[model samples]
Target: MRAAAAEHGLTLDDERDLTPYLDLRRPRDRFIAALVGAGRPLPLRGEYWRMLRGGDALQWCLLNGLLNYRVLYFRPAAG
Candidate 1:
């Protein structure tokens, strides 16, 4: 990705340098901070935390749905 961006004369900043501004301790904290800062309702705070910590699979599904996914197939791993 760096190479691809460099080809177009665009330099991407490393994320490590922005940790202080970006880190909110956890996903839940970030969500709460954003919602509260925007003066939005807090009723969904717990729900947001649950959805985030649910698992990668659930997170993927949530993101996919938000992006208007049409169809998805899932198969359990063989034991």
Candidate 2:
């Protein structure tokens, strides 16, 4: 895995950084992945950013957690 990432100019300096990749093998991640796949009904990427921009106070904590998780773990594909 590290070799593949390095080939793509990505560095895995910490094992914890692989949590998202590992989590992505689970059912929930599969569902999310499929939902965000090309031509899927959900525009998950846009929705996430939009929600972060104007989400209500009721969802503040959840949104904040999502933001933190995304920042700390999510790694978009390279090229």
The most accurate candidate by TM-score is 2
Candidate 2: misplaced stretches above 4 Å? 1-21, 38-79
Q: For model 1, how does the per-residue alpha-carbon lDDT over 1-79 read when each residue is reduced to its tens digit?
A: 5566566555554323222243333676556545454544444457655554444334344445532323222233233
Q: Give lDDT tens digits, candidate 2, residues 34-61.
A: 4444334545457774443343322344
Model 2 per-residue lDDT at 62: 43
Alpha carbon lDDT of residue 50, candidate 1? Answer: 52
Candidate 2's C-alpha lDDT? 0.44
Please report the candidate that would top lDDT against the real structure.
1
Off by over 4 Å in 1: 11-16, 26-50, 54-79
